[model samples]
Target: MVVDDDPEIVNLVHIYLTNDGYNVIPVYNGNEALSVISHHRVDLVILDIMMPDIDGMEVCRKIRKDNVVPIIMLSAKTEDMDKIQGLMTGADDYMIKPFNPMELLARMKSLLRRFHLFTQQDGDNSSHKDDVVQINDLKINKDYHEVTYRDSLIDLTAKEFDILYLLANHPGKVYSAEDIFNLVWNEPNPSNNTVMAHISNLREKMERAAGYKMIKTVWGVGYKIDQ
Candidate 1:
């Protein structure tokens, strides 16, 4: 799905993506995009930051409230803060305006591929031993991509679950922001703030459920699951 107020940009992306054999859904505004998403199984979203009615950031936040769908944001703003804000709002990737069509296509492919793998990893429950990891009262079922705290199920987005699983799988091993981004996202050069946002979001959910701290940040190092 491509959500952009600019018809030209939407058309360009739609044309190229359609040619690449993707079923593209193009929306001119954020509301339309949300409406469509509410009823459809959208794999990914390419959203514009500036729009009429609801902007991309709000749309991203709304979607992140319940959906873990990968979102790539587009904007003319080149500032690092803009990119960080977009990531903080739950965007999987960010693209500046005047971006290369081929580059966007490449990024779309990478995001889709990684997302597919993430979802696929949850299949085949017969191999539960390799898929499920337990630390204290928290149990992570990778086959189901689910988490449970003290025998109670905890709802988590795909990205959030992946981050938790990565840390809990290693227990006490600290992982830098770059390491987490590369391992979970399968993409490089994302801002550390992006990883920080995800970690903060994940920690909030887990801590709220567990009634205690789960992830610990090592000063000047990174993060690890509390053991």
Candidate 2:
């Protein structure tokens, strides 16, 4: 899916992606993109930051609340802060305006390939069980994608679950932000703030459920599921 207010850019992306054998869905606004995304299974989203009605960041946040679909942000703003803001809002990748079509295609292919690998890993490990991970009173069910604290269920988004699963699967292992980003977002590389925001969000949700913190930050590195 491609969400951009500029018809020319949208058309250009659509033509390029369709030629690359992808079924492209192009929408002119973020709201329309949201509506379409809710009803469809999109492999990835190319979202423009500035738009009428709802902006891309809000749309990205909304999508991240439940969906783990890869998002590549498009923006005219070249500032490092703007890029950081986009990634913090849940974009898997970012591209400044006037990007090469070939580069865009390359990024799309890389993201999709990683996504494929993640799904394959899930299927392969479907039956391998540590079933439950218990750190104090917090419990994470690997197979069911459920988290519980003292027997109370905790609602988590797909990204949150992925983060928890990664950490819990290897207790005491410190994962750098880049590693976490690749594992959760299925990108070859991802912005540090993207990993940080998701981890912070996950911790907040977990803390609310458990009444205490379970995930620990590893200073100068990333995070770890302290055993």
List the candidates' TM-scores in order.
0.89, 0.75
Error of 1 at 119 (Å): 1.9
Query: In candidate 1, what are the lDDT values of residues 83-145, reduced to their tens digit?
Result: 878877878778999999999999889877766665666445577798789998899977666
Best model per lDDT: 1
Cα displacement (Å) at residue 40, model 2: 2.5
* Candidate 1 wrongly placed segments (more than 4 Å): 121-123, 151-157, 188-190
Alpha-carbon error at 201 in model 2, in Å? 3.5
| Residue range with the least summed lDDT across 10 consecutive positions in model 2 | 115-124
| Error at 128, model 2, angstroms | 3.9
Q: Give the TM-score of candidate 2.
A: 0.75
